[model samples]
Target: MSLSRTAMLLALVLSGAQAGQTVVAIRGEDFLINGKPTLEGRTWRKHDVEGLLPNSRMVQGIFDDLNPETARQWAYPDTGTWDAERNTREFVAAMKAWREHGLLAFTLNLQGGSPQGYSKNQPWHNSAFDESGVLREAYLVRLKAILDEADRLGMAVILGYFYFGQDEHLKDEAAVIHATDAATDWIVKRGYRHVLVEINNECDVRYDHAILKPERVHELIDRVKRRSAEAGVPLLASTSYGGGSLPGPKVVKAADFLLLHGNGVKGPEAIRSMVERTRKMEGYRGQPIVFNEDDHFDFEMENNHFTAATAAGASWGYFDFRMKDEGFAEGFQSVPVDWSISSERKKGFFRLLAEMSGEGK
Candidate 1:
């Protein structure tokens, strides 16, 4: 095996030594899988994650795009029934490319909300739950495929369980809880150590269902942890906020690691301030903090976010979406994602990541 792969396997083995089950653990601002520090011996701090890329809403259209009508037609296509063969192929390909370019983490949503306000026929509403409340078999198959590929590639997946706008489709709060239990149970049964659970994409966002509103989101996080404990799987769990907001004290205390967003953050200074303010929150326990979603543009400004985040000893994530006039040229966050290392933005981000993390030398 290659050195990176060997190191990853060793880490998994070490972390799973206790219960003989692969798991991810939080240890003082670092993420450990099978007891070995992730991105170890890199330029950044011992447990800091440096190569997060812009892959928000990946699960939304990944399968739907296979439909004949949508087949690469729209910017974000949605035209077909879920096809396991093609979905797995495309997902694995994108993931492999990401791993090759030093991206160790990406965000995926089970139910993707509309970036533009919700519409009657939003193509990206391909949620994992069906109208009857059971987990969609097709979604589970694709999810497992992605998780399995992530485990093999030594990468981690920040799996968001729900998204705004589309979450109301579920039958009720009982359905939501059942879905959570089912998802967590499946992960534990499969022994995946590279998955982190985000109960909702942005807990503070408007939701038709009261169960998932910001006030009670902490309960979902707790449920995830409890279910993992029941299954004997050590999983990392947290929820994210909308841009320019910090999680509430209940959320701060519930999450194993803190997840922040940069949607409306003004610049690097704002990013730094948010990180600092979060660290000083009433219930803050000094867990690893990460900006898993941000849409700020420009190389200098983007660099400012990265620099500020790393300087504050926090991790950062890139958020890009496809706009009408601008093709995918900017670094990190552009839309109609090629998923390959095709854009200058992707190349620049990976190159900077290599320098920052001391990987791909």
Candidate 2:
């Protein structure tokens, strides 16, 4: 029996080496499984870059490409606003469906906020907690529910706790820490074990969004890492961004793994340019890297980007929100989802991606 066990173990080790797979796979980006580094051939998916942007109307307006000046002219559905329960059910179903296609949804926060304009997503308050405390409370309650379901489904939810671009979602030092701690606790309890803890979606501040002092980002990363550890989940700290706070130490210095939001930068070449710059950097060289957001609109685009990111020694994923049946790549304006299919675009993109990366197969 001992001989058998030894031989079996030796065979396993030999096969792993023969196949070119590393010994310990990256839980997220520690050591990717697919002969890739950081987050090779993996796409950090998020359908709506502005999922937590603001309100339905504004979201629709943008989808319609309505100019801010004429934003009011564009009327959203009479069935306005995303209700928590309904959104949860819908998201849960969407993720299940996406699994069939090999794709997964981001966290509910990607869609977190309110009609007053999703928590902190409101333009008027950018980062102020309401004196009434209504929005924030409602948000946490709903968010808690969403995380619960995601865990049940074993879905990978990327919690964007920092200031992406929704200035309204901005938090002062105290609030930021409080919120981060809260989110970590909630996710842990629910068992959603986040695939990644992405701080500040895609923060792009205009004025030296650069804080000479970057203690806050570092602090946020450490707290979440600790909280996630307590929950028994292998936590990976990352920041998703493209501009504004470009080169901010928040990303340059503070994350466990590195991520880039090359939203409009399609094709392998464009992505390569950015990947090269980062991999060659001082802090980025050895750490893992991922492309959490590349909304080029469909599986084909995801394939293009994932291939590029991986070749560059990074992992990547395409974004997918809405009911899986809604359609792929945000569903062009004219071909909007009927909201009934519940899993249309889910099939192609994820399946193709998983297959290409050798996961689906």
Index of the highest-TM-score prediction: 1
Q: Residue by residue across 27-78, what tens digits does model 2's lDDT show? A: 4334432233322333334221111110011111112111244334223344
TM of each candidate vs. truth: 0.81, 0.60
| Tens-place lDDT digits, model 1, residues 1-361 | 2434423422322222222243566787777655777666555533345322223335432333323454333343343233334434555666766666566677776775443322445444457777545777656655655676677666678898887766777778888888888778877787777788999988888776776877888898998888888777767799988889999999999898899988878878889999899999989987988888776546434356766777677777766655555553432222234455566555666666665666564
Model 1 regions lying over 4 Å from their true place: 1-22, 44-88, 113-124, 300-303, 327-337
Best by lDDT: 1
Candidate 2 lowest-lDDT run of ten: 50-59
Evaluate model 2: give its lDDT: 0.43
In order, what lDDT does every prediction score?
Answer: 0.66, 0.43
| Least well predicted 10-residue stretch by lDDT in candidate 1 | 11-20
